[model samples]
Target: MRSAHHPATGDLSLPEVMAALSDPLRIGLLRVLADGGERGWGELRAPVAKSTLSHHLRVLRDAGVTRTRQEGTRCFVTLRRDDLESRFPGLVAAVLAAAEADGVGGGVRLASDAA
Candidate 1:
């Protein structure tokens, strides 16, 4: 288990957060993180390559939305839940709501066919 103390202010840049959240993969990552308490990178089963997942995690870390720590050779990630809620109330909730509205369950969305 990795422990971290979130920075109250100026830790997460707004632009970086926006950029990180803009990508669907990153959003999926966030959703996954929300599931387990703290997750090692290996716990993720994202369809993308390990390199790609690394990039996404980096983005989230830089954005201050997540705090990562190295435990031995493995990296673990956890959402900066407190800081995030303090910085932007209901933001994460809204995202979760949007996902629910979009019909995503257990972080996976069922596809819809269009004509």
Candidate 2:
């Protein structure tokens, strides 16, 4: 088990969050976590390389968009819905909503998924 560094809600910055979500693949992974439960990396459906996925997770964590917990050799990630809602006030929902409109998480990969 290991602890992943995550920015506190109050420490979240809009630019950082935007940079984190700018990638379509990260947005797709966020959609998976948006379901409001802890999801293992294997369950994320990211289809990205291990290194790429780790980079995305780190971005989200640093931006205070997600929280990760490690148990044994597995890592579980969850969206910080309430924190985001309180700090950014509907930002998370709005982004997910926009992603939905763009076909995110519908098993269709956006172009940036190739990154």
Candidate 3:
């Protein structure tokens, strides 16, 4: 199996992670994965089209916010919890907490928002 080009855990950059999470769609994905488990792309219930979804995933992967792996015909995505915690400590938790505190939830339209 060819290993993907994920950054070394220790080398995960703050700016890249911020850029990845700055998008609402990606933030929603991260919120779903906040509980610490892998989620197949099919399991996510976002309203975006498949292509937009793929773009969001690629941005997250490239920014080292998530790890994606192919399981035969299926692809699963998960937050890099350990890596993020190790490098930035409670940053992920804080972000999610703030989102919750702000009452963010489902039904937010991503496609309607111009990025």
lDDT (Cα atoms) of all candidates against the true structure: 0.72, 0.79, 0.80
Q: In terms of TM-score, which candidate is strongest? A: 3
lDDT of 1 by residue, 16-106 (tens): 6778788777787777677547887777766677798788888888788888888788888888867888887788888867865774434
- Pick by lDDT: which candidate is best? 3
lDDT of 2 at 69: 87
**Cα error, candidate 2, residue 35 (Å):** 1.1
The best-first sequence of candidates by lDDT reads 3, 2, 1
Predicted structure 3, TM vs. truth: 0.85
* Residue clash pairs of candidate 1: none
Listed per candidate, the RMSD to the true structure in angstroms reads 6.2, 4.7, 5.1
Residue-level lDDT for 34 in candidate 3: 84
| Model 3 per-residue lDDT tens digits across residues 4-114 | 568889889999999988877778887878878888877776777888988898898988889998888788888899999999999999988987787554433333334
Comparing 1 with 2 on TM-score, the higher-scoring candidate is: 2
Off by over 4 Å in 2: 105-115
Between candidates 2 and 3, the TM-score winner: 3
For candidate 2, the per-residue lDDT at 54 reads 83
Against the true structure, candidate 1 reaches a TM-score of 0.79
TM-scores, one per candidate: 0.79, 0.84, 0.85
lDDT of 2 by residue, 43-108 (tens): 654566778878888888888889988888988788898988888888888999999998865552
